[model samples]
Target: MATEPIAEDLAGICVDSHGSAIGMPQLCADWIPNQVFWLVIALVVTFFVLSRIALPRIASVLAERHGTITNDIAAAEELKRQAADAEKAYEKALADARAEAQAISQKTRDEIKAQLDEAVEAADAQIAAKTAESEKAIADIRASALENVELVAKDTAGAIVAALGGSADAATISAAVGNRMKG
Candidate 1:
């Protein structure tokens, strides 16, 4: 019975006379063509799956990312331009405000100076009027004092002549008093 042929199954090909494995089954010549055929089928299936499904999805995702980056850069440039314009406008407005402020200050100063000048002129006019009035009053007082002194002197002289019993004329006493006053 030991010499009779053993029935062969898929697992029996690599066995020896005592049913022990010979070397490695994957390296056996009998199974090499079957392994190579299955490897080619697996590689073809993997390539089709990547090309039809996985590769297209990855490419679309990369394209979307690139478009987003480009749009973001464009938006940033536009904002930068707008910022520069706004800065220019702000500077111009600030300069205009400064000029307007200076103009207003100058105008106010001129108006104040004009009002001060008018006030000074009015005060000078009032002082001049007061001075003229005071001079006229002094002149009037001096004239009245002189007339009073002359009257008193004439009365006193007439009294002295009467006391001495000289009988002086009124016209002669008046003429003498007038000559002394002229000197």
Candidate 2:
């Protein structure tokens, strides 16, 4: 019986708190309706603020970034093009230099060949001239030896005749030569 009374009291308190407009205004009536209106207003204000202020700023920033990226890409392309041109120019110059060097080397080789040929010709002529002079000298020596032999023969014949008291004739000289040869 006591538990039944306490239960009734608790039930009464629960009904008063939940029911509309007796002590305090009903919990939902006091704030929930007003809160709903304020929530709608805040959402409308947030939409306007985002669309007019924040979203435009974000879009402009994105557009500026895109423009900057495009400009950077263009500049990079220009630099790449310039680099390619420079490389081509460098290759052309290197090719020209190699060609020029080959030409110079060929010219130098030709000049060296010509000089060698001239030097060979000059040396051959000098050798020929010296050979000719040596041959002439040998001929002169042979001729001189022959002349001396003839002169010595004449002198020896006269001496033999004088030594033999004028009796030595050609036959005697011949016999003497034969005897000398035998000895």
Candidate 3:
């Protein structure tokens, strides 16, 4: 008597008199409205949770990531620009340094050339003076040697004449020696 009402209620909902389900529970017409109502409630709750909580959090994270990426890209571009500028400056400086070095080298070469020219000129002047001095000395030596030779010849002639038992005149011997030397 106590279980009879419970069995009747269960039979009308999803079970037969023996307590087995009447058909597929999902397709049962008696349960369709309740299932549909609860399904709609669950879907609404899920939609609200995603829209109000999960989606916003996901959107914030995505936005933050996008902002970070954008900032990194901008910074990279700025650094690239700076690097290019620095390279240009470095190249300019290198060119200027090379030019300055060439100028300095040329100036140094010019100074050395000038000094060398002056030294060469001084050496040439000294050589010319020494050559003139040497020529003058040679002329003096030749004059003295000629005078000594003339005296020796004259003396020899006088001795030869005396040895031959003939009187020799100094003036005549000198005159004869001078005439022979003229040729």
Full-model lDDT for every candidate? 0.89, 0.79, 0.92
Which scores higher on lDDT, 1 or 2? 1
TM-score of 3: 0.79
Residues 54-130 of candidate 2: C-alpha lDDT, one tens digit per residue: 99999999999999999999999999999999999999999999999999999999999999999999999999999
As a whole number from 0 to 100, the lDDT of residue 51 in candidate 1 is 99
After superposition, which runs of candidate 2 have C-alpha atoms over 4 Å from their true positions?
1-33, 167-183
Off by over 4 Å in 3: 1-6, 24-33
What TM-score would candidate 1 get against the native? 0.77
What's the lDDT of the predicted structure labeled candidate 2? 0.79
Give model 2's TM-score versus the native structure: 0.67
Give the candidates in order of TM-score, highest first. 3, 1, 2
Candidates 1 and 3: which is better by lDDT? 3
Q: What 10-residue stretch in candidate 2 is worst by lDDT? A: 13-22
| Candidate with the greatest TM-score versus the true structure | 3
Q: What would the per-residue lDDT of candidate 3 be over residues 48-148, giving only the tens digit for each residue? A: 99999999999999999999999999999999999999999999999999999999999999999999999999999999999999999999999999999
